[model samples]
Target: MTSPAIPFVASSSYPVRAGNRVRPLIDGEPAFRRICQAIEMARESVQVTVTFMWAAFEMPDGRGSTLDVLDRAAARGVDVRLVFWRPDAETERHRRNAFWGSAAHVGLLEARRSAVKIRWDRAHPGFCQHQKSWLIDAGADGETAFVGGINLNPHSMVAPGHHGEGHNHDVYVELAGPSTVDVHHNFVQRWNEASERLAPDGRWGAGSETDLPFPTRIPAPCGGATVQVQRTIHAGRYCDGTAAPGGHAFDVARGERSVFDQYRAAIDAARRSIYIENQYLDVPDIVDCLHRALERGVDVVLLMPAEPDVTLPVSPERRAVLDSRARLGAFANFMLAGLAGLGADRRRKPVYVHDKLMLIDDAWATVGSCNLHRYSLFGNGEMNVSFAEPDTVRALRCELLHEHLGRDTAGLDDRAALELFRRIAKENRTKRDAEDPAWQGLAFELDAATHVG
Candidate 1:
């Protein structure tokens, strides 16, 4: 663990909020289950910022579908509002993964008479509105929020143990405290300026969609954690003259890049170890930061997808990762790894690690939708909350390690635990190569030098 004196990285868009409670909910089944229960119990409002949502996705245990949950909340006089991404020509290639308000979707909403208010937002050309969050009972005494990288697709909605075919491994953090005020503020900003708000068939539950007010007061302290909400907003995205709770008012015309800034700062301040699980680890600046950390004797583990969606041949993603490998593979203390699972056809399969989570020195950690890629770090809309709570951070690291290594690492220090992770991952890779199905866990080490290729 880091010294107790080490503080959380500062943020330009939000202030560090103390006395907040944060819980790490691993995997989609656990995350969505809690989010659904919160929606069902919501009495004031259910607000969601969706980036990618498959139309056929549903809540576990027959709770309901995404729209069904919103409809049920609305049917009970609870306000339900959703801001969904609407891809433009540049982002049209992502439309298949997003529930953009197309003619078919508009017709479905009209036919279902969905009472949920909806707004569509278009990102800057070639960028995306990639935030995935759920804020329940906004501004109420019991307000809570869910933030992470989980998407609404069957491939991402699997159980925590990962049965059947390989599924997307992801994480979501549930938060309730003064920090949640920032989430409420972000939703209001996006909802008020959603593109196509005035277009025909642009909004569902028309005549009912109303602009939201910024939260005037912070929620009371709920726990001991100190939290700071961070974001990546493209320049000129939101011009609202509002500020996050306890934060100075920025024009926001210049945008906010606090997520990227925090990541760099955390890696630079590492005293013992840095554990990060992200979809892609191809950001040049981040790779450089990790290189510096490893040079300073800080053990680092970067867990990414065995089969990254970003690394399509001849794609820009491919070039970026190859560049990262060339720079970071020189450090012996740095281990690059990926996860795999048993497929339904009784074959080894790569499970996409869609988690955007990082733990530094077992004292600071962050969880949200911001990837370590240019799109998420600079252009796309993103959200993450960093917390300085030793117990919470250490517990989350242990939980994730157990899931990946199938062993309890709670007794080990952060550095020792990650060293064990490297050994086990390499062992698992050997077993996989031998076509053995008896590997301890889903993790396996990847050759940083040629993994991208």
Candidate 2:
């Protein structure tokens, strides 16, 4: 299939490259199932980068814990490598161990005899290493990649459209063809730098100074779509290497904020519609651009969590979470909704909107770990993959709306679909206020100003 023409100008930070096949995997069941399958089929190696993980999370489908699956793959002679963010020493007391610092995680690794390599990477203090991706069969034919915001929390293991305690609505894309090469490149880049940090102590899972080699060239395209792998990486974090200037989809500089630039460009160029599903909607520049798109008669729809989860302190003092909520309360001129799930008992429960996604005019889309917050936009180490394929964007948009509205967006244009969503959301709010039994699985308007305060 020929790729659709992009109406907007592409950012120099992430130039569009062609020849990729991408499939949107909704919720944890499908995403994790596919991830395990790819690991099982790996011919050479599997590389995974995750910001947060829980030792308690077992695959809900009975395949065992995440480590078990990876161990099994490694036992088959597949090289399995993982990198998890190691919390700074000061903040370690208040957070769960994402690395080998905890006895349980170390014991888990020690028990497994497979040649699974794990590394702990430290990000710029006070920020997170918040990119999550999985690459299988790197540097070979049949290579594939999965990228998005699905974390290792048990809550994220729930299937789509189901009501469970701590239910979440998220997305991950399974990619094939040349796009996997970029994912492979990112993993190697981070692993190399992380190894340098570990070399001094000869600990933290960096057994040797030599790390995985960067792919000498981009892999051959296995399909029809085009992709641009983008990132927000601070300078000096990757001390061992730097991205040279030019047509590369990412930049290595003192402050490379390509993810933010891409979001601004995509929103500014939106013509007919804008659809977003994210955990936070508080970035000033992004909000301003969305407001302008609204003024231009673009239909705007945003989905966020009805209740913010501040279960852990993202900062030393745990004040950033509150600040984020305050910032979210200040947006205007855009239609916003808080999504909730209904149960068999007809109870309304918030379905945590953990997806970082945006669809502009059904012609452009992005999916990954970067949220619309200052920390994510300009401070953290984040990654996102975007494409200018209308059919793929439209299908993913329809699928998400259908899950949120409990009906298909059949025969509706992008603008019409958003408008219909607005109507259903308003009606659902009224029904909930009236104690109506039918207000089960609909999104309701959010009073951003009053929601937090």
* Highest lDDT against the true fold, candidate: 1
- Model 1 CA lDDT for position 426: 87
Q: How far out, in Å, is residue 39 in model 2?
A: 0.7
> What is the model-wide C-alpha lDDT for candidate 2?
0.74
Clashing pairs in 1: none
Off by over 4 Å in 2: 1-14, 90-94, 195-209, 240-253, 310-333
Write candidate 2's Cα lDDT for 1-453 as tens digits: 222354433433435678888899999888999898888888888899978887777875688888888878877888878887876765474357365346666666666643677777767777778899999988887888999999887778877677444788889988887667678777888887773245443233333345777775566776777788888887777643433222443445455687888888888877788899888765657766776777676778888888876443355333544454444334333567888777657777677889899988887888999988877888788988888677888899888888888878967888788888888888888876776747635588776554431
**lDDT string, candidate 1, 303-405, tens digits:** 9888777533446865765676666767777788888888867777888888899999899999999988788999999999899899999999988988888
Question: Residue 444's C-alpha lDDT in candidate 2?
Answer: 81
- Decoy 1 TM-score against native: 0.96
TM-score of each candidate structure, all chains considered together: 0.96, 0.89
